[model samples]
Target chain A: MFKPELVNTIVDAHQGPDGLLTILHAIQEEFGFISEDAMRQIALRLNITRAEVYGVVSFYHDYRTQPVGRHVLKLCRAEACQSMGGDTNAAALLARLGVDWGGTTADGRLTVEPVYCLGLCACAPSAMLDGALHARLDAAGLENLAQEAL
Target chain B: MRIYIPCDAAAIATGADKIAAAITAEATRRGVNAHIIRNGSRGMFWLEPLVEIVTPQGRTGFGPMTVADVPGLFEAPATHPKAVGLVEEIPFFAKQQRLTFARCGVIDPLDLDDYTAHGGFAGLAHAIKLGPAGICAEVKESGLRGRGGAGFPTGIKWETVRTAPADQKYIVCNADEGDSGTFADRMMMEGDPFSLVEGMTIAGIATGATKGYVYIRSEYPHAIQTLNTVIARARQAKLLGADIMGSGYSFDMEVFVGAGAYVCGEETALLDSLEGKRGQVRAKPPIPALVGLFGKPTVINNAISLFTIPVILEKGAKHYADFGMGRSRGTMPVQIAGNVKHGGLFEVAFGITLGEIINDIAGGTATGRPVRAVQAGGPLGAYFPPHMFDTPYDYEAFTKRDGLIGHGGLVVYDDKVDMAKMARFAMEFCAHESCGKCTPCRIGSTRGMEVMDKIIAGQEPEKNIALVKDLCETMKFGSLCALGGFTPYPVLSAMTHFPEDFSKAAIKLAAE
Candidate 1:
């Protein structure tokens, strides 16, 4: 499903400043995650080493090397959320799902990740499920969200 | 009938979209013609999904509206249970000065006509008449500092880029707002994007830089989408492209999305990231003003600082400068968040006390608990206990007390918070987000966390606390950037202000 030619096209389109990050974003947008083959293809087209590409990919928290689940839930782990009992709610959700931080459920339906902030701090205890944001989540709210995602 | 509903990310998070859909369905069923416009949030977040019906007087408000309240909207808006009079009359909105966010939540963000009608491009138009030197002079006169943590004079930064001998210069708007409680950048971009487009164009004109890039954080997908749409629209309308408004000035801009890296918020690190490298901090002496972004002179400013340009140009320097106290001039869109009730963005002049902001403005803790500690600024900022609440919200005032108003965000905490755990989190966060460019930050933060863990475990508390103090000193002075430098503020502030929380005896007492 990961096409080398599509990677070439993405690399070609972003040939100027910020080309590498743009290309990686495009590749990730096309596929669920950036594979070694795709990174190699990108490096070849961009005239950079595979290690250089990997360094960038590894540096940013957004870039994933492996495929994600059907739903990716990003829970806010910042101070604002912490003040609103986000730690307890997050712990409860993770416990209910039986997955650690950055872990995917056994059913392959949900993957939970910790994000520092989403700029929705006014409504603390925020989470983003598959790009749509949910906020003001208590323990029960987080549980119901995880259950729905699972 | 015309209806206004916020499409802001915060509003959407709290089910604004569902309420909008419910209102539409209910209106259709009743055979009533209703027009729904997705506006930006008014910063009164507690009352979000704050539905407004256009009345003869003004936009009459009703919210935090639910789907249950939708049917009543059409029946009798005046008698609706959620009705809260006119939107402008709300105390939270009416009390403060709203310059930077003047058009936000007021106009349809994408509509150029709507933007123009709301006095959007007047600054850019005025900048064309003033010329580059005059524009710089006006900014210098205004005394506007960076709304980002540093509080550097914006005029001087532009003057550097303006005079620097470079055939090709650049204007970069730092929209990578990574601060936890801050959302002014996101709100402005999502709400009134053209203001940024216009402001950046003004910066380009003032600094003699034709090319601009708004480096936005990828977490704000909606803001990115909104900015991109506005950029394309501005281009099509001849506002951004060559010979903008036929003034013989050609300036254009693009949105560059940043991957999730907290250090990328730093100007030098941001430049490195922009160049497709690891976002490591570049040492100073040939600061980004001189050898920046592909070895050319560049003017980098925070999104808020740049967005405020138009108003300064339109109203003149003194008018904008007169609002604030001391060296800190102009209004800051202070984001009050976390455990507080009525938590939202309040754009007020500097010198308002933190006590007023938390207790009076924010209405204290949402859980009805006593306010314990409040973190002024981002993760890197120092924590202020309630006793220190009288300190005015000025740059010098906060810095005098060992805190910085980094990005104008205040994350409040209730009495239930454990200061020791919060202190550990500061070190942990710094270690997690460190760029690994310098040893003091990279290694010191990890060591600090470990020492904190030891202190928490009641294992040689006095020795570990001393070690942490030493580690903090190294990180504070020796680190490459603010990420490591300011991490000590919260840790030391906690230890000093809430000593009982850090003591093993207190922990034992609490347990018993």
Candidate 2:
């Protein structure tokens, strides 16, 4: 939904070998997700094909092609959290939300995604709500947070 | 009066920012004039958002604080409910030697004056005087090795890069710390960014590299922001860019944000990512020293390895080298994580036993259950049972047990852990993260997961176990990089140390 001028402004700001990543990041920051039209414009600006842009976008976990919910919940599933009952907590959270990994709730209030680690392993079973991390998360704590997010 | 609270990602994750604001507001309301310095974590993560009041006695600690408790903190700073006595006296913080992290929680990360006042940049100043070879020789004398898993002598690597003839050599800092249970790099970068900036500048001076790139994972947004700000500030102060500090040598650095790819933590893969491509592992023969980062000779070191350089130079190589045991000569920032009660960052000399780390320092599992196993290193590291806790944290000692001191991340597990499931998770993680460039890592991981599932399902359990062993051997010997190669360490070690857990999984399936 971005205007052509705004798209061009973002694309024009980057130069050199890192232009693609820079352009994509700027676009994602300005807009919620990368659109197909944006990809085409990026391809044209960077002198690469849309397929290459798509490949890069899909490969990385952080880039989203579609719009997301109001709140993004990233639950850590790495070894450190796993050692602290993250699996059980992850399962409970997913079941309560009625969504799988990377799925958004029906009301568009929350989206639960699986992240490898958030470096809060010392306070294990951590989760990040819209980029703010919460550690030592129990079932109750998570449920309360989820309700608050809703 | 002065007060300190962490603005580190780990601290911020636990609401450190909110706590700082509350403290500021509370102090104003109470008509108390106080200076609030947002420092980094002391590594006592359990006491996160750990606030300290600089009392005459010392930096008195009050922790795990929230907004609600801020008002009370102003009323009675020392006698607050969250007060845990002096920070240095707390058993968790008292029992460790912190070298690279010495200024972590003590100084304002963004303040150059604070950093200089705290014995920072002395290394760079010394390196400028010593010249390239002198700096390299001192590092050699210090016996410092790469803190990022490989344990290769850092001085030797620098010497190689220094000798390599390239008009456009580069220094690539591998900040893509993808390993689970490892946050030392992130913490260091977020807490003390100028240290890294100084270290890389020193590398540029020693190796004659005029340009550098710090490739950090996108997951660490806070670290990226911190580093960007520091790099700009350093540039403004002439600590970086053309003719740094009025010296003839010119070096500049840029921060490259990486998309999530565990394999990119590998040096060559990081270079590929830097070049705006998929992070597939490259074969080594020419080595990164001869050819790296768009085929130019490059000096690629992990964040910790580079960060340690400034200290090595400032303190004199011998002084830093005198701290650790054997060839692993220096302190290690061991992250005590997972189920541990007082899990935090404990930087100690080499040769500290795992038993002491888990029992004495960490205070055992937070769940109050008996420690079942401890996974030292990261996902690729081996799992050690309770009996093996006597093994020291030295590089060679860990290698002797088929374990790696990879990033010095230690994750503890309690009695409820299932070895079979943990083994499966290793393969699952590898399969997901594999770049699909090598056969063993790409296909073998999926096959290993299938075999593990069969064993758990009790379908020819004995045969499945044998198949897993055979598969792991192939993946170990046949894989191109550590991602595929070291995945077996966790899988095989779990099955070897905790065979009973595997048997129980199969037995339960059989009973069903």
Candidate 3:
């Protein structure tokens, strides 16, 4: 729920902050993701429509309109990662988790999202579980890491 | 005082942590006044584990260090020390025209005062006085182009978005620098997170948008951490909140980590991924200006493009614009990668020939072999032979010679490189990275790969060669985005310049 005062504050807040990315991030943090109420509040506050607010939320990959899991499992899919079998490792992990990217596990313990490079070129096939790095991973290594999460 | 050590993945791969640990243990053993702070790298990668002592002058350097060398540092072991000598006089640091990269490796990345002391907020301070239109005009006059490959005029893009009527506007910085043999963006973000923040803020002011996003590749974990730490500090300082500098200008940014997709480096594709889509390229009639990031006016600039804006605004336009030759105005941060000695970041002005950079600055191949083809930009960039080594490094000149000045990444190959294999790699890269947006790119890339396979196999080699050419031509004209369009440059350039390599396959096939 977004308060009228918060809406006015957020709208007043929107003028100089680029568009609404920071507001959306804040809102997402507060409510787990961008809510219809938050969008409407932003629209009313900024003198725009709900569609406008929703549009901003949906445009950038950073903004989440839906709730993610407790821990985010981000797999590296950049070129160097691919050269080290990132695709195969990702597929094997996905099969074990039984969910596609942006999909959280049934127990809500983990969410798998595909990520680009983690900048570990020399040590390839890397992944980030939550915010920590795991490098030079084979499929078995990733599954072992995934089991720890389970 | 805490001695900063970079264990960022790049530095770790090069053994930064072990040296840092060794230094700490050595310092404790000697009961000296030193503690190690595992900081992000300064981006001068050639100097890994580049230890800096807090001298009264500044942070001093001694580098490419190992754990064995750490204990020796206390007793003065650097064959070439940074602090003892004029730190600024080092040829690597001295030769660079670091506008965007000005503060990198010079200060504590998390300290706001450290940033300000090193001339960090001067641009933001100056920009606040001039207003949005004034900032845009200054950038326009500077003739600063996008440094993240395309080299389009940054000022013009800012002006268009500044003037464009919008209910909402956005500034999206593309930090997805997937091009191989390039590390400037990563190095900058890790070394000088504040500069990028300052640069993005300047863009936000110029574009009249209240929000910004940095779509950094997930590969840059150290950069991400440094940025996150810096953003928190900036928010606390009221520099990035509701009213920046009490100027009624509000611009805040959040970093969005990208899933692996080289195609996402393209502006439209980046926009799509930002919107939580599949990172696919879109047709540009709506051209991110009129309709971008949620179908609103958006200023999508590369990391280096945004990074250059603060300096352009702080210093006058003419002062900034007076750096380079015609049309290719301002400095280019050339990234020297792959099989070259003295390989690292070399930010120089335009009009410098390939030979001067590669042969003189880089000192030729690392393998002690005569250099053959030099690939500028990245894998998608054209490979030039020894004859074209004198070509000037600029957008117009590169285009004139049927090549590109993409992202300033120059990957050198020795005489041992098979140009034919290199050509096949271009096709293979396109096939793998294509977003499957258009037939010519998606379908044609696979065909191109198959055709290259046939030639490599010597199966109807002549027919395969013609097919590859035809496919490249079709992909050039017919692809929806640059993924297919520019793939031909590497393919055809190899075909024309390295005729003997491709022809040998046919001759070998005839003999069979």
- Report candidate 3's fraction of native contacts: 0.08
lDDT (10s digit) by residue, model 2, range A28-89: 88887899988888888788998999987876777889888899988989999998888898
Per-residue lDDT, model 2, residue B14, is 81
Per-residue lDDT of model 1, residues B333-423, tens digit only = 9999999999999999999999999999999998899999999999999999999999999999999999999999999999999999999
User: Which should have the higher lDDT, number 1 or number 2?
Assistant: 1
Instruction: Give the per-residue lDDT digits (tens) of candidate 3, residues B193-237.
Output: 888888888888888888888998756767878888888889899
**DockQ preference between candidates 1 and 3, better one:** 1
DockQ of each: 0.87, 0.74, 0.09
Instruction: List where candidate 2 sits over 4 angstroms from the true fold.
Output: A2-4
As a whole number from 0 to 100, the lDDT of residue B137 in candidate 3 is 84
Q: Estimate, for each residue in B121-151, the C-alpha lDDT of model 2 and write its tens digit.
A: 9999999999999989998998888888998
Task: Return the candidate ranking by DockQ, descending.
Answer: 1, 2, 3
Which of the numbered candidates is closest to the native, going by highest TM-score?
A: 1
Rank list by TM-score: 1, 2, 3
Whole-model lDDT values for every prediction: 0.92, 0.89, 0.77
Q: Model 1, residue B403: displacement in angstroms?
A: 0.4
Give per-model TM-scores: 0.99, 0.98, 0.79
